[model samples]
Target chain A: MIIPALIGSLPRPVSLSKKLEQYYLGRLSEEKLEEAYREHTRRAFENLRRAGIRVITDGLYRWDDIFNPLIRFIDGVEVNGLFKFYENNFFYRSPVVKGELSLGENPIPEWLNVALEIKEEVYPGAVLKAVLPGPVTLAYHSINEAYESLDELAEAYAGVLAELMKELPVELVELQEPALAAELSRATREKSDSVSAETAKALIERLEKVKALWVVTYFGTPRGFPEGVILNFDLVEGTLPENYRGDLGVGIVNARETKMERRDRLVDKLKPLLRKHGKLYVTPNTLLDFLPESVAWRKLKLLGKLGGE
Target chain B: MELQILPTSIIGSYPKPRWLLRMYSLYELGRLPEEDFREAVKDASVAVLREHERAGVDIPWDGEMGRSEMTEYFTAKISGFKFYGPVRVWGNAYFNKAAAVSKLEYSEPLVLDEFRWIKANTTREIVKVPITGPYTIAEWSFNEYYSSKEELAFELARILNREFTLLEKEGATFIQIDEPAMLNHPDEVPIAVEAINRAVKGVNVKFGLHVCYSNYNLLADYFDEINVSQFALEFANRGFREMEFLKKLTHGELGFGAVDVHNPRIETPEEVAKAIRKVMKYIEPERLYVNPDCGLKLLDRSIAYQKLVNMVKGVEIIRKELAKEGKESIPFRRSA
Candidate 1:
């Protein structure tokens, strides 16, 4: 069965975006802001339900990027300079690891719990997936003064994430590792072994607490993946992995562009792969956060149409 | 063109007044007509130019009042682009993101009208026209047309070449191509430099490249390759840290950012002067130009004005110190 799913974040509606801005500016009260967030959360779920996206995200409306709000919850990390999230215009604060890593007050479970409650009310029986920044990507983008190597830092992050994932009451979690493709590709081209497949696999292994896990990589040519991992390949900047035995995510939707995909063309491309892969979910190659809200919504609707076909 | 040593300027864009923003909202809602909206923009541009003059800025543009976001504005004018709406660049802030849908073509001059308006309005001998650079425009936009990203950038560069040549023909002396996205991909720096060179091909104007909030060290290797007279970089935002790279700068003048525009806190003349003093250890004052870290559009208008006042005051402090060494002023070097 084919299912439509968002890879990372769905663009926040303009009204909610304004409210968030006001809340950050200290113009809006937390109570009122929370009310707005709850209302927006329901709207997002309703939109997804109406569009027939079964495997849904919470829209990650509160997140600036994958690193943010989560980084704020982690000990020994300070938010630093804004770095571009891959080649896209969207930027996230680079996390500076100044001390040993540990979980502080994790708000992911709380945020996800609220989303799940809303999902139950708004779209009963819909699968709500929790999205987190994968350890390898986080370690690569972060400034690491505290750790000996990026692998060590990634492992440290996996320990923190393992603890956090245990708290999340969700069946599946999508760990976004764009660096797995973009950075690693560059590293390989330059003959620098900055991050290794073993390191990434080790990090994923530690997160066995989650009921199910999917590693989504995007933005460049993805190298080797450890066996038995449910992998999502971004077909836009990347190709499907060779001879992989797992449930595959067919990321046929172009999340980076504003152009609407022709459903017929996408189906033709996916037909051969669809027959081969046992379990497949149709998704965007990258986060829709790069596209305009209207464009992203249209893409999601297109994904729904593809899934239905 | 001749100019004073340590000449003060803004890195383009002054904060739009609240009234102008309201006018913009009304204009977008169709409450105000296009003619009225154009007039309002003209009024705002003139007002900001006067403000820059009063703030003692040596070289200023029309505050970029006519343009909304840099790349979006250009995309709207050029062919083969479509806007989907605004995308968030950071917390609560967004810019209208566009996608290259087909082969990019130059239908009209992009910044010439604004350049003509600012040139007529400002009393300054040179107005720094800040066009969003080709590398940045291609990098920021979603490319659906080009076979490769390099092709898209070069296509943009060809179109921009026409725009820049037009501006130069219109008696514009200086053009600061804003390429904040240039250094994002270090591997693509060669293409970026090539794109910039292609964009400025045969334009023959004093060119400045304003790159903000980036590791300026990356460009140090390719500084001579890029055909620009000045490298306007943001330093104040990072507390003027990591400027040891300045020692490697072999060619062109440096547009030193003395005031931090992202922060709301007002900087003192002494503080700005101290930052200038710290930077002057690597480069001489004659080759240095003082400006804010980036566009002042993010700051409140009053705060933006005051920051410029302090920036000019800071430059004045450095000017006095340079005068003590008989290096008071120098001719503005017109070639890269």
Candidate 2:
């Protein structure tokens, strides 16, 4: 059976996004801002349910950006500098490593609880998917002052993520690794030779507890990878491997673009994989946050329809 | 194009004054008067000229302070174009990439009036005007009018060529066509190059083509093929890695960028000279022009001014070395 899933984030509504930005800037009251965030998350989950997407996300509404919450949870990482998040116009606060890594006891569990409560009330049968930056991605993007090697830093971060997965009730874990794609964007021509196969294999071994660990690659396809981890690939940029016979996760819809792909077209495109794999995950090529809120939801609906067909 | 030494100039654009940026937004919203906004623009341009003069630049612009983004600045001036919301290109870097819905026609002279203003104020006989290239304008925007991007870029080339001829009539000595997106689409380079040639075909002036934040190696193959007098490219950001590509060039002056605009740290005069010296090993000193990697718009005004000052001083260091070697003032010719 095909699973229609959101890789990460439904686009926050235009007005709500504005308010959240203001909230970050301290122009808006905290009470009022939290209300806005709650409102947006509710709408995001409902939007997912309407699209018939059984695997819903918490919309990552509380996240200021991808690297923030996780880095905030970790002891050594500090958001003091800015680094380009691939070739995209959005920037993430560069996570600088100051000391030995530790996941400080915090309220991250409570952050997902609100969304999980909303999910149970609205779409009872829907499986909640939690998204995180892959350990290799986190380590590569971070300024590792304490860690001696990239693989070492990756193991430390992956260890933390593996622990968090146990505490959360997330049925599916999607690791958004756009950088894993050989050529992330037009501006980025270099191959991602940073994440070694050994480190990826080690991280996958650590994440064995994650019910279904889907390593999602966007921008372009990973030329090579560790074998055991389920690879969620962008169908546009990703080619079906000839040798690999495993559960495949294919992203048939493009989240960055405004153009729509019809369900029939997507169904035809996914037919070969559907016949080959026992379990299939249908997703957008990248995170849907880049698109206008209306267009993103429509694409999700198309994905859901494709999952059923 | 006989230069005794390495001449100094800016690629295009300077940092906009905070007040000017505010007025630009306010005026667009009808909160501020057009007269008030235009006054700020004029004042800002004057300030830019003064900064260049203070830095002792041989060739300078009106600071490209009159416009905001390179391509969209033209979009605002052209007819039959509808602007869209901000499209993110990199982290926190968004440009309102517009599209041409109908046939693009000039409602008025594109930068003629602004050029006239800068000319009236400056004593320099030679000044350069940089207009966004057709290929970049087409590439940056969503195309609705033309069947393909190449067709749309050609149409833009025809439109900009009209302005080119007009600039020549107005006695503009140097003109630069900016195609920062040129390397982004390599397969379309020939079409883009063709469109560029059409834009300045008959107009006689020292024409340059500028590309930034891209791999210069991708462009080395067709350097001589490009129908332009100069190739103004950014190298400071890449730590001057591809300077070896200069040895392959058969013709045209190289606008060598010595200051890093992407980073706020100022490169010292000695450091900048070292970069220029690396290029001199491949090309003659007379063929090299000093400039920053790209526009200083993303940087602070203080950083921009200091960077220009240091860059101008760097050229001075190389000028002395060139004079000692008796290679200065060699007439510009095809490199053997």
Candidate 3:
């Protein structure tokens, strides 16, 4: 009865002014932000632990952005200016991969160092989890300058991330495939003949190289989930379509709301499903602008109960 | 024949009242003086229903005026979520992004106390209560709960469905499930549609699904699977292309967003009229209704008022044009 709990990044709430100041001042010097971020990350983990969350993550507090640092690991890829995704958020743009792509001096060691520090200081005894944006999503969202095909870029990204995963120290790795569900159509639209099977195969192959992989998909459907990708993973994490097979991670709680009582029923409904999957994970819907600490703790308690921790 | 007005369907957008702004500011500032904020929000909820009634809006939304962020309000009420901090908006629309927050639980069910309050205050023909759809809730948030995003969305949908059922029992005639994120991630349409349908399953009320501009090129095909009666879409600000798609999709009444609520530019009655006339060519006048593209929160009170006024005038102009041509008058419908 081991239910999976959020051992991944929970959003960090920093005011706009602070975020800007930090971003502009080049204050991302590990020593400065790391100390404060580690403290914040410790508090988040402690809260989850107290709420009975069995697994934990550093909340990705140390990373300036999810894509940039990793892009630095790939050789021949010039980091371009950051693009503002929609509003206040931003991500680094990578130059196109024209030729043979390979990993530069592995930046995984630096990432792993941060993960290890968070594990040591934050959620000391809890199962550590690491989150990386899925390769397909990264390739899709990134600007492809010199590449003739997205498949080529995706393949390159897969190799880079897989290599990074091999070097990182963590019990479980959650590769967020959010873009897969929603962006698949775009991928198909852009490269109709080469999108689906190619993207799915590339993802599945890359995921196989990792030890404990949870291929997480969100926002839209990845035409290949239950049929294409999920079967290949160690644990298929996400709210599965009613028709999906294997394990279940019932995401019944909403991250935007301030309440918790509504999630209780979600836990109850997921119990039978969890039994079928051998384990279940209760998660909040998504990270939004406001979530009261009390509600988060309650969700962790439920996950703890389900996991028999 | 009095237009055979039997209320064939329902649609509307979440109305963000002025008081909700104050509450959000307070909550964002981390000084919500507890009792005061709650009382004000409750009052704001009542005001939302009243405003819709005054505007003759078909489906009355509680305006989502009571909550700071649509979904965060509930998570805060529940015990699992932790208040991480303000949400960061990406670019110029930075102010529009509800401050960032985080959650940690998925064990408690949402209580419909606010819904019950809205239900108690209104005696209107049919109140259309709005809830943030599960997919939008999941996409908008920083997820830490489940291993994947879909799982999180589905779980939220289940919870929302429970609330929706309860609201229906409490006298809601329609539910406008808002999911703007659907535009950002079109691939999740099937998953979102399923979650939404599941939430409103067995509930007898008319379900009005509202999705904003996320490249609605495939809207015709997408609408074929969703079981909802009316698709109250944001067409005006996004453009007239979506209307053509809706016309081809189905003959069902479309709640066409006629007002540009996002931009501060107040559309004049003439401009609104011209826009309506243009869209009416594609959509039968009888099956169209005027509304703002999305919520009015982003606009100032005067701007929203002008936008709505121009919208009503636009509809009036279209009505006159149809009458002159011996066509049937279009009944009023809500928009997102």
Q: For all the predictions, what are the DockQ values?
A: 0.42, 0.21, 0.07
Backbone clashes in candidate 3 total 81
- With a 3 Å backbone cut-off (N, CA, C), the pairs that clash in candidate 2 are A88-B90, A89-B89, A89-B90, A89-B91, A89-B92, A90-B90, A90-B91, A91-B91
lDDT of 2 by residue, B1-336 (tens): 564467777878888888888898898899998888889999999888888878888777877888878877898788878764555443334466676789888777889988898888876656778889998888777666778888888888988999989998998878888987776655677888888889888888788888876656667778877788788888787667656667776677888878888788999999998988888788776677778877888788999999999998888888888778786664433231
- Candidate number with greatest lDDT: 1
Considering DockQ, where higher is better, how would the candidates rank from best to worst?
1, 2, 3
Per-model TM-score on C-alpha atoms: 0.92, 0.78, 0.52
Task: Report the poorest 10 consecutive residues by lDDT, candidate 2 chain B.
Answer: B327-336
lDDT by residue (B1-336, candidate 3, tens digit) is: 123121222233344665666677887698898788778878877775666556555445565666555656656654444444444443212222222233444454454676677667875655666667877766665555566667777777777777777776776666777776655544566777777777777777767777664445545676767766667777665445435565565645566777765567888778777877776677666666566777776566656656665666666666666767777543433321
- Candidate 1 lDDT by residue in tens digits, A149-179: 8888888898888888888989898888877
Better of 2 and 3 by lDDT: 2
Q: Judged by DockQ cut-offs, is candidate 3 incorrect, acceptable, medium or high? A: incorrect
Sort by lDDT, best first. Answer: 1, 2, 3
Cα lDDT tens digits, model 1, B1-336, are 568889888788889988899999999899999999999999999999999999999999878998888888999998999877888887677888788998888998887778888889899988898899999999888888888889999999999998888887889888899998888777888899999999998988899999987767778888888899999998887778778888877668999988887789999999999999999898888789999988999888999999999889888888888888988777877676
- Backbone clash pairs for candidate 1 read none
Q: Write the per-residue lDDT of candidate 3 for residues A77-137, one digit (tens) a residue.
A: 7665333232112223434454556788865566556666766775677777677777776
Indicate the residue-level lDDT of B106 in model 2.
Answer: 73
